[model samples]
Target chain A: MKPSDIFPTIRPWVEGLVDVWPAYIIKPQFASWQVLHILSLVVLGGVSILINLRLIGVGVTNESPSEVQRNLRPWMHVGVIGIIVSGVLIGMANAERLYDSVAFTVKMLALVAGVILTYGASLPTARADGRVSAGVRVWFLVGLAVFGLALFVFAGGELVNPGVWHMILAAALIVLIAAQGAAPVDLSGGPAGAGRGPVRGHPFHRQAGRLRAARPGKHRLCLGVPGVDLRPGGLAAVHRARSGERQAGQGHRLRHHPRLGRGRRRRAMDRLRLTHEEGPRGVGPSTTPGRGVRSVGRPGRGR
Target chain B: MLRDFLVWLQTELGKGPGEYPMSWSEALLGSLNFWGLLEGTHLLALMLFAGTIFVVDLRLLGVTFRRTPVSVLSQKVLPLTVFGFAIVIITGLALFYAKPLVYYHNIWFRAKLVFIAIALLNILLFHGRVQRNIAAWDTLAKPPTAARISAVASLSAWIIVITLGRFIAYDWYECGKPIPAWANVLQECAASEHGAASLAEVAQ
Candidate 1:
């Protein structure tokens, strides 16, 4: 007997695992994780859309490019996770059919490229602070474009081929939803980037942070954590600041707290992004409370 | 009655060219070709459609890039839409000619054309008067009821147009034979001789 013939015998349980539910029908097995997976897709999909658009030449006309990247950076994790969850769900639902689909293979490849590009491009350099470089944007765009093209081909082929229109339509709906969720980016005002300044003085950078913080999901909480700052010096500053805020209460900005920057950093020197910047160069978490919001007052205030 | 009418239409339009008011030129240039051109035009139109629809939907749903004035997006994309749709209509007519008497006699096709006309007329009648109200909805979390209705209608009509057009091929129900009437003669001559005898055929 051929090895193939014996394979099923070897893997005894593999043959009848999937019951005869028409593979085309997206079965509604309501696991807690499935709903969470869908929900994750929504959250991460939206964040991915917003960031990808900013990477492209789409929305947020007035904000500096770097600011757009910073605010949108962390949220991309949600989008990647969403894509993974939704992708796996859909793939499992149509495993037999998708296994042979050229579009599926291409999309998988594109997604892999996208993930790699996102990692490679979104790394924060000391010079750029949290803003992903244009080179990063290029890779990000390639990733997005490849992914988008994969989706378009995958979905479009199904329009004329064996795949059901309903599946294609549903997928398209998800795409549009994700697209709508993404924030826009534009180069109309100037080059889509940020410059080096104290994070205090950089409203563009701050605005990016605020946008992530304002997101109505776990992204806000995830990003709101002190150690998640984009700059190397960000985590320590956030840690100290959070401590001050908790100790001092809501109305008291960090300006009231004094001399704790030196004392705290020496203790927590091996910590987060804020470790270096929290030093007493007079712009410590204590000295600078709201000193850096002026540029954020530029034309697109809602940004 | 509607089903019967549709069945009757299918019976009538299945007849060939000599028995119908359709010609080669009419098929190629006059109607079918015209609408096929719309397929090309639709690419541009689809973008504008997406653009306008995006703004309106976002306004209704309350989303971002909201800072760009709603009126501006409407004005920008609406003109492109109109221009694109003109191509669609012109092309649609060409497509209709590709099998005219059959298409003319097909109830579904007739209904589709009627829907197109209705969609067009609706835009003409209400779009201008309603543009301001629609624009105001852009920044609102919940657009005013009237604007929402208009948005819904606008979206609905476009969706219907697309769906019906697709179904035109799928749910095609042609009528039986047609008499070679004067219009049919014009089309015939146009088919055989490409406008050479169309004037005389029309005069006859």
Candidate 2:
């Protein structure tokens, strides 16, 4: 349904809210309300980007996916609540103007979808063992794509045709989903590579054991290596394996995980991609190199 | 000499790019659709810039990410923050370029510049004075008073900047508009100076 149709029923409720709000806020040009909106975006948009980055597997590698999620969760709540409060304040104050503005309508729809996508798919994927199935990763990307479209429409103005842009965005997302399909889509239901116990002679487990035997200092040093290649997309499997590698000291081969090195990361990406292309369902030896955990990567998918 | 140079600079800057022989600047100036794209990007970049700073400021105040070393977290987030900052500055310049004279005379725009200068100074002071000792207290649940002070200052400055930046859209001192005396003094509000001339002529 179009936004215009939905607003009439809610108009009275919005007017009531506006009546109780501070008098200063009633003015459409109120500076304080505008500042609140910007500030809330700083919180909401910022945390959303960080959480989404982690979900896709490339932020704060030092922390476990769970740790990243836990630490950022409070801020996420604060941001979400702040945005809603400020958004409602602003929306109520200028309900008529917003009701008429297609940009506002697009923003509201995107906001709803964004909140759900962020909290539902992204946050859960992050909280899950960092080994998300490819299907789950697609869910995260879809949320990002939708949020981006909403932002584009809001910024582009209501006057512009959102229909054309929506179609363009949908096509782009479809391509991304199709590209991701080439990688293994996790169907086992649990974390992509969790549940299966440590495999003997497996790279991650073997390294973890070796590191455990080495000087205590080496464990910290080895852990430091992952930091070397922590680019923005360095999300789930590599990091998850890094932790497993740390504990088992065996996630990578003794030679060192190419994923950990800048030059070698492509091999890891290729391996993940190959898993998508080669095996859609069954787990293979190469399905997850470090301990049966496959995460989103393209750098090393060639192998 | 400096005053003369400043005047000369303003005079030169006032020349509308549209009048240039190449006409490329003019073409860009004439395009409302292009400016719309820039506006979209400017807002997006602001979100990124503001978001990164918010996290870093929180960490400085020792509110969250306590277990992780502050340095590591900073290192990881620095690139995104820088990328966001670069985009904001670029888009901001383009927006300013589109209507230089109007923006220059805008009170809120001036306020935004002042706020940005102060924020930058706050950053410099923190990195110079407080940050040297970061290693000592980076892991603490509550950072030292100095770091906390900088965090507060940075946050406050940025909020003011954002507030003033948004308010810049309001024309507090337009050419034909009757403005307050204080504004007149600050923005050279002599009626003869403004007359009924276009903003491009005023810039010249």
Candidate 3:
């Protein structure tokens, strides 16, 4: 059955909610609900930005992605809960108007997609400390493609009407994705280089290579690569393996090195690992470095 | 004096379909769908700006990020906050320029500006005084009283600003409507020729 057919059946129940005392009291104070809704968005959006930044190797590079997610998860929970509660009140008060609004339908669909992506894809990838498996990455991209197609089909070939509210939602999504992809390239010191190709000539890649050459055994903390291990044991093993090669001739001790601080070390390693992965053979960046290959870098980076 | 200046600006900018019609820039921004985009950008930017600031404020208040050093958290998050604020200011001004007279006569918009001023002053207090000595308490889970107080003030001011901003969309006490005397005086409703005409009607 079409949504047009279903909405009528649901409208009476949804509209009935406003007669309840709490919703009824809030019906007149519509602006208050709007305020609450925006405030909750601030919390949610803020926390999401931080988490996504961590996943893509931008801000708070010192902490593991999991740690940032763990610490900020409570705020995200608060935001989601508050948004839902306040949204329900507002929705009930204006049930009739919303039922006819295509923007409303698009918003609900987008919300469902957002919730699923956050929990299913984003959080899991982050929790794994940015080491996304190839399969998961493929599935995430597939999911996004399907969602976009659904939006297109749902709107009957035209994307949605170019209404202000519709565009706002679309713009927010674009900004979030763009910020994730572009930050590594734009922010000079960020670890993840552009994902599309072997950025061997990029200054960050050169700096990372120099750093790795200077220190053989210690792998730079490359969260962007899949095979490189960030765990303590894996790190020690890589150090042991590489130190064996170093013992032949290159004997150096910069233990007191000013540049070898924890954060710098991690970033250098990340760049070096990414560069190594995108070698002269022009292998693509990891299928799922964190969330998806698209998120890690723009399309057609290999060229 | 302020109302007179605003009235002068409104007149110079012009309004309506008279010989001295609305300014081209104002008309373009006001009439087009682009105005809606400007408003949406302002709102989205406000979320980013306020959200990031609240994170920093929470850190200062010792409400969250207690384990993370105060300096590190500030260093990482403040850049995003600054970026967000830059967008907010640009879009906010564009929005104001689109309807300068409407905003000038709006009580809620006026209140929003007052709180924005307070928020700016609070920032100056923070960087000028509180932050200069950050090295002293850089690692503390709870910062000094001055720092905490600054955080509280920042939060309170911005919350009021956001609420007032949302209230601007409502016409509860619009200029032409019959408003309380204090509100009319605060809004300087008698300053503009239009406002004066409306006030005179209310008096009658």
Candidate 4:
């Protein structure tokens, strides 16, 4: 069924509610709903990224993926409930207008699909394996596709006028394309395969050390521990080494690192864009201090 | 004397970016096709930057993701966060260049900048004072009160900043046009002689 079609059944009821309590949404105090909506988004997006990062084993290495998920799960529920309440209030305030708005309809569909994928699929898999299952990855891409479609329609709402069926067709096409595109990429391994069963030798650690050892002059450390100065060159060198190791180890390491999903390499490129100024820098641990851990931030000679 | 200096600065800057050769570039970017693309990237970057920061702050609050040491999480997520922030900076500047004077006179725009400054200051205070001894609570499931307070402050600052940034579009405060008297104190644009220039001339 078309998105517009599904909403119509309840649109009359919602419109009636709006008519009775016009000031509920129109009054100045209703602005808080907007604030709450945005704040809910902060929580939702925050926890979503946290869990996703955990899945990739990038953040919270000390905690198992399950522990991370369990800790954040309650907050995610609160965020979801807040979003629902705020979202309902917003829709009720301008029911008729929103009912007719293509952007609104698309946003609702995306939010539903996103919720399902997030709570139903992605989180569950992350809870189990500390990594997103391949199936969840596909749905995740579809959810992103729908979300992007909503954004597109919302941004260009005035420019394009499409019927409900047309929007649904477009959304379907987007999901189909995104699923096809994401199918080939292996997201199961996590970022640089960091989440794969922990091998005795931390591959990234060794690569980081080797790269640091190879190019020691460009870096100046405040302490004797590794810090987050992983220049593009260093990461590129590490990327190459990781690729070779993946081939040799075969299935032990991920072929592609889900740095932050698709377009990660572009994001990486942005980080590396400043490489010309800080050439041949050694990749190291972040600068935040942790007692008893070897930080290795002290200045050392370059190879 | 201070008022004069401020007026002169506003008048000069409020002359709009169109006065410079960069205006041509701005015109190109402001085109319907390009503007949409820039906006899309800007939004995406915002999500990444905001999302990453939110997770980091949550860790500081000891709210969740406690298994990982704070230092390690900071190191791992920061590069990507910086990358997202870099995109936002680039796109934000381009957008500003498109309508410098208009944005300059906007109260919401000014508020956004203020919020950003406050957020940065909060970051500084946290890193300079509290973070120096982060190692002690690096693995604590519930960080100390100071860290939690810092986290709360950071989150609040960013929320206000984001809200203000969004409002910049809705509340356009154009130079060469009348604005609220209160806004005049902040912008001094409405009364400036330079404010008399039409938006077209500003685009020129």
For model 3, the stretches where C-alpha displacement exceeds 4 angstroms are: A1-17, A133-146, A149-160, A163-303, B1-22, B29-32, B193-204
Highest-lDDT candidate? 3
Whole-model Cα lDDT of every candidate shown, in order: 0.44, 0.63, 0.67, 0.60
Q: Sort candidate 1 into its docking category.
A: incorrect
Chain A superposition TM-score, candidate 3: 0.53
Query: What's the CA RMSD of model 3 in angstroms?
Result: 11.2
Candidates in descending lDDT order: 3, 2, 4, 1
Find the 10 residues in a row with the least total lDDT in model 3 chain A: A291-300
Residue B159 lDDT (model 4)? 86
Which predicted model would earn the best TM-score?
A: 3
Candidate 3, residues A128-174, lDDT tens digits: the string is: 78677776676577667656644654555232344435545756655
User: Backbone clash tally for model 3?
Assistant: 5
Per-residue lDDT tens digits for candidate 4, residues B1-204, read: 544554444344334544353334445544756666666667656766887788788888876667677887787677768877899899998777665556666778888898899988998999899898988999898889998998999888988988777667663455455554455667766455555444444455
- Interface RMSD, candidates in the order listed: 11.2, 3.4, 3.7, 5.0
lDDT of 3 at B73: 86
Q: What is the lDDT of residue A30 in candidate 4?
A: 53
TM-score for each candidate, following the candidate numbering: 0.37, 0.64, 0.70, 0.59
* RMSD for each of the candidates: 17.6, 13.3, 11.2, 14.3
CA deviation > 4 Å runs, candidate 4? A1-17, A22-32, A56-62, A130-303, B1-30, B172-180, B191-204
